[model samples]
Target: MRSVSIKELLTGKQLLQEITVNGWVRTFRSNRFIALNDGSTLHNIQCVVDFEKFDDAILKHVNTGAALKITGTLVESQGKGQSVEIQVRDIFVHGGADPEVYPIQPKKHSLEFLREKAHLRVRTNTFSAVMRVRSALAFAIHQYFRDNGFYYFHAPIITGSDAEGAGEMFRVTTLDEKNPPLKEDGTVDFKEDFFGKETNLTVSGQLEAEAYAMALGKVYTFGPTFRAENSNTSRHLAEFWMIEPEMAFYDLDANMDLAEDFIKYVIRYVLDHCEEDLKFLETRLLDEEKTKPQAERSEMALIEKLKFITDNNFKRVTYTEAIEILRNSSPNKKKKFQYLIDEWGADLQSEHERYLVEKHFKCPVILFDYPAKIKAFYMRLNEDGKTVRAMDILFPGIGEIVGGSQREERLDVLKQKMAALDIPEEELWWYLDLRKFGTAVHSGFGLGFERLVLFATGMGNIRDVIPFPRTPQNAEF
Candidate 1:
């Protein structure tokens, strides 16, 4: 008998075939039935085992968290609820899990409680479904870029300069924390560090990915990026994965197209392949009534929205226009924003972005040409001399999922921008050299991988979608 995937069993027509499955028991109901998941799919395989045939001693050891190998005959379920089931004939206990100590039980547990047992949370139905959706979305990301002729580039983790220029970085050093080297000016001597410079974890891979794109014509980097930001919100994470795609001979419009298409592709793939898991998440994770038909809830709405994005074109709006709309729509002059975006030059807050995408646009909106003073130095300055060629893709539920812009290809303009921003020119010599030698018009964007996972699974928090979330003040497991 060959092993069959749970998804295959659910979708396939053949029944009464002998199969073998190896997995940890999610739950043992009534001491005669078991719910098994092999991590193959989000849906668990329900097995009906007769304790009379098996030894009572052996059955006693098969607890909730035990690993087991079951040889069973698959049969079309005649039960009123389930579609398929397996009748077990032989059972082998591979590992035993004590019921008293296992963190995950058959009953309901809070998300905060599950976060504490991050190591074992995947055994639960919600986490299992989330992980499956996460895996599918990640695969879709790679497929989208690869199909479009994008070369995947691996960027360095430990870097000399902060790529985001945000000054939030976790220093990488070998010096003793208690007795650090001192300079003549009575400051810490960064030159004596392990890297012999002020090295920190990479905040973004865009700078390095740009170099490869300029050489290779089209390149993308997908890897872990670290941020030392202290604000612990549901959306923020200390360590997360980012997908950055850089294209040569491309501008802001082309970049937005790629971002939109990439998001649509991933969403479509996950919805198509992980239907069972999506259903599980829709029922359990989102807290929607399980009695309602699976298609009735907002998951269908999300699917419809994604299909709309995939089939139709995205709406483009300038930042100035968006600000004007916001100002006109609100009667109160001093309306309190979460991040306080009161003026035109200030950065857009999540509240403002959500309002525009959710209420005004009613679809994914690509807002471009933001104030240059608020954006990074690499973005190309527009003709107005005030706004830069930066764009942010905001979705209804998730705001600013993708951030990218056209690079300042001209050497003199880039140098001037860097000088105006007060960034050290010596540190970016190699980056500037690309422009001096043979830099063509190029653009790229960084898509937060966890955010994409959150969007795909409809998972609310950023911590739930990631396997081992590294958030501020939380690195357990």
Candidate 2:
């Protein structure tokens, strides 16, 4: 007989018919009822067994985490929780898991505990729902770009130059670690390396995407990015995914509009397609918040918050205005902030960003016109000569969901900025050539894929959203 997933059997396609199902047993209750899930959806199908007919030895193998194949007839469930169940006529144990040794028992486990068991964490309800939503969001991103007439550009994972100039890169080398070839200057020689020059995992695909966008007219890159920063915060990940979209003839305002629309579209997509997963996560969040203090709980329900974002426009503020608001705020006056906002050029910390988005504005906020020195060299310099046309979209829970800016198309200004920052001109000759030939006002932004999952699923840690989180001192899985 052809096997059907438990998800399909529960959706009411047909009833009172014999069928075969394959899945892992979530729980074996009363030795007669089985909860099975195959990762197709959040809900599980209940399977009832007639213990009097089956031998006790065969029934003992039906434990949590055990894989099973059951041939049964679907009928209306007599139980209260589920609408339908399977009456098993025959059962085969594909894989048996000992209850005493199985790590994923039928009980609540802490997120920290689950992190150690990253390989098997998805079997749990919380992690499974998160991954489902993550998958939906990824598909939505591609669909949005394709529907908007943007080509999906595949940027190289290995590159010779750091696009951000952040100086925290994981070098890719094939040289011997113990005895590397050294030059006359006492530095390791990279000429004999695989690429014949120093190369590393790409930190961002923005530069390469820009090249494609200039020719293709509109392009977007969705791929993995690496950063060797050792800071192990809840927000930082050693390896993560980035979504960068580059558009020709786009100004700062247009860039902001696209980002806002792109984000809401993805969220709405998940709401439409992953309703079951979202509902389970909402219940999980509500239950989790009961353990926290009353003041720390969320102001609105998870679904309500998502609806509010899609229904309203993000608040727009300038860097100067945000500075004024932060400097005069009660937290700054009372010395409550860890990093106080003292002047105009100071970079905004997470606390300051959250204040503007959650407390002051009470909605999503887009802050633009950052100081030139604080921003990257590629951002367009403003008329004031001190500020650049950079914008950061801050969400209520996530500090900076998207960061973007208009590129400096003027060849002289770009070269001067690069020279002032001591960036090697020879390495980026091709990039500079774009500005020299037909460069006409391009802009793009990068959205951290994990941050989006964190907001959508209401997961607390950034590591929880990703399957195998790469962090400092913790790359086991």
Please provide, for model 2 over 1-477, each residue's C-alpha lDDT reduced to its tens digit, 9 standing for 90 to 100: 999977788886769999999999999999899999999878889999999989888899999999999998999999898999999999999999999989999889999999999999999989999999999999999999999999999899999999999999999999999999999999999998989999999999999999999999899999999999998888889999999999999999999999999999999999899889999999999999999999778877788778867887999999999999999999999999999989999999988998898899888999999999999999999999999999999987678889999999888999999999999899899999999899899999999999999999988899999999999999996
Candidate 1 lDDT tens digits, 1-477: 677777677764658888888888888888888888788876677899887899988898788889998998888776655688889999989989999998787889987899889999988878888887888888888898889999999999999977788999998999989999999998889888887888899999899999999889999999999999997888999999999999999998888888887888888898788887777665564464354576444534445545655665668999999888776655224665555555688677777887787677777789999999899999998988999999998876677888999988999999999898788889999999999888899999998999888877777689988989998889978
Give the count of colliding residue pairs in each prediction. 0, 0
TM-score of each: 0.93, 0.98
**CA lDDT of 303 in candidate 1?**
54
Name the lDDT value of residue 187 in candidate 1. 85
**Candidate 2 runs further than 4 Å off:** none
Off by over 4 Å in 1: 12-14, 285-301, 331-342
Candidate 1 global Cα RMSD: 3.2
lDDT of 2 at 369: 98
Note the Cα lDDT for every prediction shown: 0.84, 0.93
